[model samples]
Target: MNEDRRGLLAATAAAALAAVAGPAKAQESETPAGPPPGTPEGNPGDFDFLTGEWRIHHRWRSGPQSAEWLEFDGEATVVGILGGICSVEELRIPARNLFGMGLRLLDQERNVWQDHWVNKNSGVVAAPGEYGGFTNGVGTWSSIYDQDGVTMISQGIWDEITPTSTRWRQRISADNGATWQETWIMHWRRA
Candidate 1:
């Protein structure tokens, strides 16, 4: 096998260990007190499952407040870095002439993940990225954003995970978490 195969196998093994060990070992030195109820403590290799090429089915609105939905197909390749403590996903949509990168870093000290998006056109890391971790097999990372001068809560959810496929949804709400409108949704399958 080549180096890529070796690295992926290593990442997969590390992820298995983390899942079996739970968060106790990872959080032992970081904080004696666990995260507030319902929050999952992040661990290294949490994103190892994403370390591979993926075919993405994308759906999104034209604008944050737009009701019209557009669909496209894209491709993505995710790689594990920093010993699985970090992962980078490169996304490409040739039809739309759009490309972007997603960086997910594990905050070992805080036991959470910080997710940032970098647009190819801007070449800047978007400020105030979402922060959250997996709980009961579902991962939710969220942050606050200002949309048209109104404060909105934005969430990126990873669910319906399987060995070969997963679903990601992005939703926003101006009224706290009382209501949400899905802005983008993507179905990812191993490519």
Candidate 2:
């Protein structure tokens, strides 16, 4: 009777172990091997130039404000946040008391850059616009606004860049690009 009791206890323990382990083993087998979330799988090289910090020197003038110009120091940071689908850039200008955020995304099908921008003061965002791809290390976008009794059209271009710095220009045309009134030109040094 003692030997039978011992044998029964061993069998019960083995059965419990199998019952617990069976589901876990099956789950592991069913899981598919795939790339991790937010991993950049395609065309990651297109936006690689925008992944740094920069100190910007901005200059601008409009209409009769040409002689009495506005100057300010600003900064820009572009990072691959949020699933690597796009890059977000934050720009800060202390002299003009302005700050802005911009989003840049590359459309694989269209082979163009989709650019969006917003200003802190106005709280208005520019509409979706297409950029003529980055070639010779340059890209630009422009928008027109008629808010607060001011008809202002603005254009921004990333003209040049190195490992540690970038040069950008923000030009505003009150009378359209036909007679462009250069509003802000800035150079950014890496910080």
Candidate 3:
């Protein structure tokens, strides 16, 4: 190529690179906003208690009208990330050929945590997850969803925490949180 042509090409490439890098440089310098004034701060290590391998005892109901309880055994592994600001749980029931994952993320700015679940069958992350934060030593998260054209609420609680064991239970409310029916419970022992 001619000298002029080469010079023009170099300038054009430099301009293009600058266009891409300028905004990224600005973004790098900007810090994420924290919780608003008067909003409580969240503990980054809130999920640290659950980090480890666990043997799970599961008791679940088939549906809202189910009278008989089904009991099963499962295993779970919990991993803490980002200094416990985020955690993931992998639960497997080999006998039933079931696998599921739960991901919990803290929204530092909002001072709350969101819980998401992904079933192996679908391999999709459920969005707009249940939101809550740890209170004392227990964690409670809840969400509202439509069930048979009715607005139903679902809640999950983590309690009975100890060094070697913990208990989690799920409840559903058809009356807008006025009443709750326990549907599933799991006991976790360190494995």
TM-scores vs. true structure, each candidate: 0.77, 0.58, 0.76
Off by over 4 Å in 3: 1-42
Residue range 38-145, candidate 2, lDDT tens digits: 223234355566666667787766443556666667776666543444666667777667787676655556445556556667654454442434545665655556
For model 2, the stretches where C-alpha displacement exceeds 4 angstroms are: 1-44, 62-67, 81-85, 121-125, 142-155, 172-181
Model 2, residue 162: displacement in angstroms? 0.9
In candidate 3, what are the lDDT values of residues 16-120, reduced to their tens digit?
A: 334323566564564233222322235788888887778999999988879778899998777666666777677899977999777777777677776766778
Candidate 3: pairs in clash:
none
- lDDT to native, each model: 0.77, 0.58, 0.73
Task: Give all candidate RMSDs, comma-separated.
Answer: 8.0, 20.1, 14.1
Give the per-residue lDDT digits (tens) of candidate 1, residues 6-99: 4754464345334424578554554323233345677898898888889999998999778899999998878787887877777899979999
What's the TM for model 2?
0.58
Stretches of candidate 1 off by over 4 Å are 1-39
- Index of the highest-lDDT prediction: 1
TM-score computed on alpha carbons, candidate 1? 0.77
